[model samples]
Target: MFKRILSALSGKKSRTSTPVSSVHADASPPSDESELITVYDSYGREMKITRNEWRDNVLLPNLQQKWSDADELYSLIISGLNDGFVADLIPAAAQLVAIDSNPERSHVIQGIVLLENGQLDAAETTLRAGMAKVGATGTLLTNLAKVFTERGEQALADETLWRAVQTEPNLENGMLWWAAIQRERAGEEGYLQALRTVAALPGSWRAQLWRARHYLEHNDVEPARALYAEVLAGGRFDGGALMMISGDLGNNGQIPLIIELIGPVYDEHKHDAMAGINLLRAYQELGNADEGQALLARLYALGFMPIKSQLDQFAQVFEQMRKQDVQGVPIDPESLKFTTLALNQPIWHYGLRNADWFFAQKPEGASQVGFFAFSKSTDGAEHAESQREDELGRLSRAIPLYLAEAVHYWSDHVGTCYIQIVEGGGPVLSGAEADGQALFDIVPPMMKYFVTGEIGCSGEDDQVQWQIALSLWDCATRTKSATESGSAVKADLGALVLDLETRLLAGVGLGREAPLDSFYLRPTAEVLPVYLTELGQSFMLTLLANGHVPKSSMWGERAMLDWPLNMALHWPTLEVAKLMYICGLGKALDYQSDVLAEYKERSLQMLRELEQARSPALRLAPLVWKVFGMQAELHAYIRELPADTSPEHKAWLDRVSES
Candidate 1:
């Protein structure tokens, strides 16, 4: 019956008259006489009456008519209409006009209708007008802003939203929406503020989590960690939060803390790949390599690929140890033995400098002082023990320790070695003759090996000369082989040596050119032939061509021997080659010019390769014979060339011919 009435009111059904009007003649009169009405008898049969009969005979005559109020009339009319009926009855213009008086309510209804009808402009206009009249308060402004935003007017929408927030400060909805808008506009800070406001609202876990992330992004680790812990303590075990905190702690080098924090999380959720991976890294960084390896095995059992980068990093720490003899310093048996035997190595041997120096150069926050000593098999165990005790043992050892005294004397004054000897022996050894003899014995063998690859003990002065010769040899060899190696090797060596030289020279008050070449070069050269042969011509040539050889030599010599001038001369030829390649010709040159310029370039290149070859059979004759034409120009100032040759041409010819 209700369906029939609704269909009839909507004009989908034809109406029939009912006898109830005749039975109840005291009822209200019909508003429209021609309108159809359907009446059903209790027996389910329809009864009909003529319009005139219904209006005059039964409806109109019995009705008590009164003047109609417009508001009441409008209400009655609107009540009778469905959404579709109202839309069909009222024109858009009439609706817009009706909105002026009760804009909020009118626009709300109209906006919905317009939006439904795909009339975005009409909807926006209606919503904005309604909002303007209502002072941007309550749901009206929020709805208006939403419509504007939906239509892609974000700025306008945001403006309206802020107004809405201000209009109803106590309303959480407006504030939350406004906060969201701010977040979208402004990035992390905006989001953080917005999320904070959101979190103040009851039961906003998602908001709180985002706020924590904002703290983490800014490196406020303590707060981030605290927040995450708070969340977890509150029984919020989010996987993402756990992962983030773990990674943060690991990156900050808080390896042990990271493991402790994430251990439970990992155990509870063994299936989590990220947790497993991070756990592995944390263990490795904390020096719990065994534990880290075990975790990796566990991850493998759980069907995960082993993280290669973390594995490599762990391997590197150990590999670096193997390359250097002791835990910290380079591999030197004497230094190691002395360090081991000394109860307090820093005080006894003077090798460990002041705490200030160590602290300044310390790795990150490393605080502990430790040492490792090595005893060579050739240095008889008893002799090694005696030397260690003499140099590093407590002051009560009774035996005079010369090396310990020398180290102590050298540590105090930069150039005290020479001065002390001149002053008739300082603290280490007494008497000029004894001091000179000790210096000669201690320094000469190293010097002789460097100069000529032979240990010559002719005399004290002879040792000094031998040492100088070795220094020259090292510089020559370093320069000669500079063009053969790759740039990375050369650069690494250079940086290393430069740092060493700076330290050594600074310690001794000696210039870089001081003739300590024999001390450094002889040992270096002895190992160089084997080193170069091991690194074949190809590697050597690549290193030299890239100007790495000189850099390596400089670093090695400076750090090991403190030989400045010798280190400076190591890669002159290679540097010259590089200069020529960079300045004289580029790829733009013609093939003929490039070939002509290739001689000096090729010669330097071949020299590098030759250093690498094990035998002459491995050498390329073409590379050996190739001469660099431009390099000969280096000799131009030494001798005059033909009168026909221009200065530039002569310079170029001289550089090539000189080499």
Candidate 2:
């Protein structure tokens, strides 16, 4: 059988009738207080909507006598009826019948609404009338079968279903119903017989697929494979077809066949998640680690978060397999080379201004400072120390962003992080290890100062310690101008970074006390590393979204975004924290992560806090609402912005509004 039955029906449990509890449920439309209406499927897919969405989408168009609208109202009609909108849907169904654009569909929905409302006689009469007017359609006859079944006339129900499938063997529900009856009358043999009967029809792709699945279930390989190929070559060969074939085959322990059948036809860009997942699992089970890794990359690029856990598991397994093959190997020198490099690219933040804007606003002749990420010390002494590659990898990017933001906030100079692009695509850490002369030549010509460093860890376990040594090079003078160093036990790395930030500020000749109303809050020691982690991840996700970084270059747990978003609410005054949170949200929404709805209420709660603030960051509230597709709230907030807002912020707001 197919993994999911295709039907234009409401409840998955019973397409023919909704429960009595649902029938008597409240039908009042949601008010503004209930900002979103969430609808979920049995498969765990969720859709967000507004209360009047049905009215706006279905009722109003039908009311305007738009005939074209009537043809497509079947799906919404199902939703409306399921949500206990029988009172409203009754009239809408009548309108569809009158529109006559798609008579069979309109009449079937009307019949289903009546049947669900317990008006069986009216339902039967309407269905009969529809058949008389438009001739027999599979859907209409299917409903008539339900009416017969409701009255306990099993014989009539079977006959009606048989006729329905005969009329349209491609109708999945009818074939399913007929085949079930056959199975009950006899057994597996009877079921196969029924499926074979339908499969014999000229355009019976669904029937052939059902029969093929039956064969696969019984371990009848040749027949199933032949039927599958025939169904695939038929006109209905598509993602859904492939998903069913692959899913059934996988369920029967035919892993290799999943790859053979699905790998060639699967379109990562257009196919559904299940097909890609089946193929990915096949690769993993068959130990095709490279293909598994590549497929995992493509799946992640799809940005659908519902299957994130599965993708992450495959990623971890693939990485482990890859590591197993390279545990003691030396680094590949060729992997370090790259082209098309640039610096000072803008990282996404909700309220923060862009780099170009900052460049234009800075004072003339202001020293342009560039901070490169500190690379791990490769010396034998450091190699013997306790170190985690993951932590080091994160810190390599985070530290430079922290230092550059510190300089921008504390001094008048225009400071920015300098990241070297990796060959395939990623921020390169080893580039920071280059000598002063090499760094001077690689950095932007406009940058007058460069801050580079090396981080080393020593000791072991609980006694582990971290050390950082930073040098400030005055490129104009072609010499090192100042140097600073700091060390702390592992737990106090944040404190180490704080001390270095203070010293680095002084080294660059701006060591004044922090402003009482500073624009950026110096994160507490506990929050420093986590906030920096969030900042680094935000930059990478932003790059991935903008196509600056390939999806294949990404690795690590999705908590890279999750933990940072959760921590953002704690650091309200830290602009980087807020930016990190928003950029994380942008990626989640862009990828259609399930977390978006999970976080929507929280986003709105944050918007309430943002609304009371006077900072330019307050404008981010509308974008948050916009990203959630909350049109009413977004427009209302846009109208309420202060009339004297700066042109730059206003222009940004206008673009967000229009977009």
Against the reference, the lDDT scores of all candidates come to 0.35, 0.66
lDDT (tens digit, per residue) of candidate 1 on 1-659: 11122222112211221100000012233455465444332112244544444334422222112013223223322322321233332343243345335555556555644554557788778766766777555556666666677689988888777666555543445565676667688975785677676556554444555555566667776776676666666654444556656776666666675776676556523234566677776765666654664454444333211232343354444333333432322233344311012222212112111112111121233221111111111222222111111111211111112111222222221111111111111111111112222223333222211111111112233132111001111221222111111111321322332333233334223133422211122113222322222112212122223333333221111011111111223433322122212222211121122122312322343344435543231122221232323323334333554566455544433333432
Root-mean-square deviation (CA) per prediction = 33.3, 9.3
Model 2 weakest 10-residue run by lDDT: 1-10
Off by over 4 Å in 1: 1-180, 184-190, 200-210, 213-221, 251-256, 267-272, 306-659
Top TM-score model: 2
TM-score of 2: 0.64
RMSD of 2: 9.3
Error of 2 at 539 (Å): 7.4
Worst 10 residues of 1 by lDDT: 16-25
